[model samples]
Target: MVSITFHGGVGEVGGNRILIEDGDVKLWLDFGRSFTAERRFYAGWLQPRGHSQLMDLLEFDLIPPLRGLYAQHHLEGSPIPYEEAHYDAVFISHAHADHVDYVRFLDSSIPIYCGSGTKLFLEASETVGHMDYGEHLYKTFRTGDRIRIGDVEVEPIHVDHSIPAAYGFIIHTSSGSIVYTGDLRRHGPKGEMTEEFLEAAAEAEPEALIIEGTKIDEEEGGLSEGEVYEGVLRVLREAEGKPVFYTQNRRDTDRFRTFYEAAKASGRRLVITTWTAHLLSKLVKDEHLDLPDPMRDEDIAVYFRRKRSGKYREQDYYHWERPYLERKVTAEEIRRRPGEYLVCLELHHFPELIDIKPRGGHYIYSMSEHMEEEALEEELMRNWLSHFSLRLHQLHASGHMGRRELLEAVELINPRRVYPIHTEHPELYRRLLRGRRVENPERGRSYHL
Candidate 1:
């Protein structure tokens, strides 16, 4: 008998931790942070204790209380005694925080498998961001590779998403084939990759399908990547010799490319943060992505903010960021010639507006509409824009499929049973996928096949 349990991503947008057990083999799909659940108890500075994260998370029932699943160091002072690795391996679907952040707690002995590109993203995050995925034995796989562990043979195929190197999985077990769609869309630059994944999944004639429904209840603008580029280019042209500021998910390289190409077309250099510059430098190694080398890209410039010294000294920045000092652009330079660059500004960096002092500028919100947790931040952002007299624009292409496309893909795959995860409206799948075996899985409950 084969069994599957949903530890997270039950009825939430993120925090995906699914456990699969087949005979003597045990593995997890994705170990992600419970963003929605965590927000309920903790916000901002109030967070779980770093050293006792497992204990803190367990105290509020934020994560699963599996005894042998976590690292011994994290479980040292916890009531649940530490144990050796009990799982065979963990398969990560993508590089998104919602899908991969909690891997830090996993036992180091348990091998972690992900796409080669996915590994690159993880490495970049560790270097530039405050994230630490811990010291797990990592094994990278590509699209066509078949990885075998114990009795199961897992085939990973690439899918199109907001971030590059996203994938879905096909697990061949004794019972049957199980297909897992690890967040995908057919409206981005690599829509064909999604088609290829779906076609291959259908050919396998899987017994079960685990899919994401992030945009199931929400109405999308139905904009494509090309459309996003067009909209942004129009905004750039309308800037009228003023600096154009934009905000997007720093990890969304597709959106970055959209801005990069649009800036190039408008005869403006795209200014990015050192964080993004470092990420791009690491990602450039993958020739398949065809991303421009930030160090050598003539159209790209790194923006340096006033840091600790406020003097723009070499010692003020981290070693990873120091390499880009030669390519740095200052606020004064942007203030003098605003029209020459398209500046990347996150919400937290709004204070820099006091320096750039662009009386009338265009600010593009190239991201999803604010979520419940971001309501306060949105208000503050609006206040900043109002104070700066900046015009706001919304131009974005979603990384997830809209309702019609999602339904169409489900029907095309035609799996024996459907389990919906990473969604607030799992019941909607039942209403839409009528006459089908749709299972609205409850967290911590095991379903046997």
Candidate 2:
């Protein structure tokens, strides 16, 4: 018997995760944080939102502290997994914290299957000094590579999302095939790779298909990520002075290029911080999406800023350091004539500049809700962006698959019993896959097939 259970990421965006089982062998798709919803719940430690609306924005299955998945550590001798859940593998689609951050809590022996880029970013050796992880066996496979663990033979078909080396997997079991789209977007520098992977999945004709529904609203429209880049470029051009683009990390190299070209043409500096520089270096692996170490000229001054404290020591710089060519600046630099500089910063950095400018510049809120407080405690959020005054535009694009692409992928794969695992809009997927046998399984409630 084969079974698939939706552990989280249903009826909500982000937090795409599930557990798929073929008899005794169990494997998890992705275990991401509920992010926005989780912060509001764990307010003190997380976002610290003050009585903000509940952030049950995304749903997750496992209980807190992650003991359920680890099969160890019980609270006051309560009911635990009778069988002690042991997964053969945990496959992560990309680097987005939602899918990868929770892995540290799981059992270390479970082998992790992911594309090369995903592994590169997770492992500390690739980025500056290595970060932390829970206990999990790390294994890497390329786009077309396959690996076996017990009865399951998994093939990673490369797909594009917001990040590099994102993928959907083809899991072969005794019963049939299960194609799980970890997370994906239709347009990027190497969009053809994602299309090819989807095309082949259609050819393989899997028994079941699981996909993401990040952009389910009717308003998302038909614009591809590439199309969004074009539109966002138009927005950048409207800026009369140095254009500062606050965005998520290096995944959107294509979009960055558009900004870079615009900045270069306008004879402005294309400044990037040390952290973003490191991320940029890893993404250049795809030949078609290459961005050389940014060279800052007199007109193109790339200002680099280090935190006042020494959280990231200078000695920690890695192999990519040569390319960054970074020069550190102080908070005072940002307050100087806002039009004279184009500075990029994430939400946390906003507080540092609060003393310098009190709202004249613009803020483009990029990235997912997973990173920020449900609402930045007014003082912290306002203080950060206060120094700079001006307009705020949310022209950022998505890194997850939209409703249409998910539908096309499902139709192409032609699964026998399609399960919409990670979506707030499983209904949309349901509407699109009218003729297919679809099941929306609940967490912990196992149904045998």
Candidate 3:
């Protein structure tokens, strides 16, 4: 008998944690944080204490209370007694915080399996952002690679997503084959990759299909990556003589490429932060990914903020950020010639707007809209942009599949039993996928096949 447990990603988007057990072979699919829970318990500066993090989270039932799963350090002083790793391994689908953030709490003894690009992403995050995913025995695999753990043979297949090196899994268990789609979309630049994955999944004819339904709501019609590029180009053309400031998920390399190309076409240098430049530099090494090297890319220039000491000293910045110092462009330079640069500004860097005051610039928001109307950050962002007299242009491509596309994919795969995860509207699937074995899995419930 093969059993599957849904720990998270129920009645919400993101925070996916699934455990598969084939007899004694127990392992996890993805260990992600619940974004919905995180927002409720902690906000802004108020966060869980570092020393009593596990206890705090457990109090609210944020994390699963599984013994022998968490690291000893994290379980220190907690009520739950710590034990050695009981699981075989952890298979990470991608490096997104929602999909892999809670890996820090896992036991270091359990080996981690992920794509080569995913490993690089984690390394870059640790190097630049000081965010560590904990030290685990990592085993990197590429597309078409099959991993064996006891009786289970897991195949990692590449899939198109918001981030590079995202994958879906084909797990061969004693009962039957199980397919797990780890946050995939068929609308991005790499849509073909997702198609290939679906074709393979269809051929497998798995007994169980574990998929993500991030955009399975009333929301319809999404722009493809190409469309997004075109939209961005149009926006840049309109703001010909004014500065164009854009905000997007820094990890979305495809969007980065879109902005870079748009900037180049408009005869403007894409000014990125030192941290972004470092990430790009690290990503460029992956020959499979066609990321431009920050060091050699003429159209790219790094931005440096005036830190403490009142001087742009090399010691002020981290080692990863120091490399881009030579190619740094100051706020004064951007202020003097705003039209010649397309500045990438994050919400935290809104203070820089005061120094680089532009008369009437354009702010391109190339990201998803907040699900909540009363999102504090979005309200605050608008106030800042309004004060700067910046026109906001919302142009973005979603990282998830639309309703029609998702339904089509589900029909094509046609698994024996369908279980939707990472979605707020799982009922949509039940309503649309009539006559199919669709199961709306509840969190912490175990379903056997």
Clash pairs for candidate 3: none
- TM-score, each model? 0.98, 0.78, 0.97
Q: State the displacement of the C-alpha of residue 144, model 1, in Å, after optimal TM-score superposition.
A: 0.9
The whole-model C-alpha lDDT of candidate 2 against the native structure comes to: 0.61
Instruction: Please give the RMSD to the true structure for each candidate, in Å.
Output: 1.3, 5.6, 1.7
Cα deviation of 213, candidate 3, in Å: 0.8
lDDT of 3 by residue, 1-449 (tens): 89999999998888899999999999999998887877888866778897787788888888899998999999988888999889999999998888888898899999999998999899998987778788899999998888999999999999999899999999999998999999888888998999999999999899999988988884553888899899888888988889889988878899999999999999999999887898888888899998999988899999999888658899988777888888889889999999999999987888999889988989988887633212347789999989989999888888888788888888898899999989888888899899999999999999999
Q: What is the lDDT of residue 419 in candidate 1?
A: 96
Task: Please provide, for model 1 over 1-449, each residue's C-alpha lDDT reduced to its tens digit, 9 standing for 90 to 100.
Answer: 89889999999988899988899999899888878898888888898887888799999989899888889889988888889888999999998888898898889999999988889989988987878999989999889999988889999999999899899999988999889999899989999999999999999998999999988886552789999999999999899699899998888899999999999999999999999999999899999899999999999999999899998999999999999999999999999999999999988788999999998989999887623234347778888998989999988888899778888888999999999999999999999999999999999999887
Q: List, residue by residue over 154-214, the lDDT tens digit for candidate 2.
A: 8888777766667778888888778887777765556677788788777767887777666
Highest lDDT against the true fold, candidate: 1
**In terms of TM-score, which candidate is strongest?**
1
Stretches > 4 Å off in candidate 3 = 219-221, 370-376
Displacement of residue 83 (Cα, Å) in model 3 is 1.3
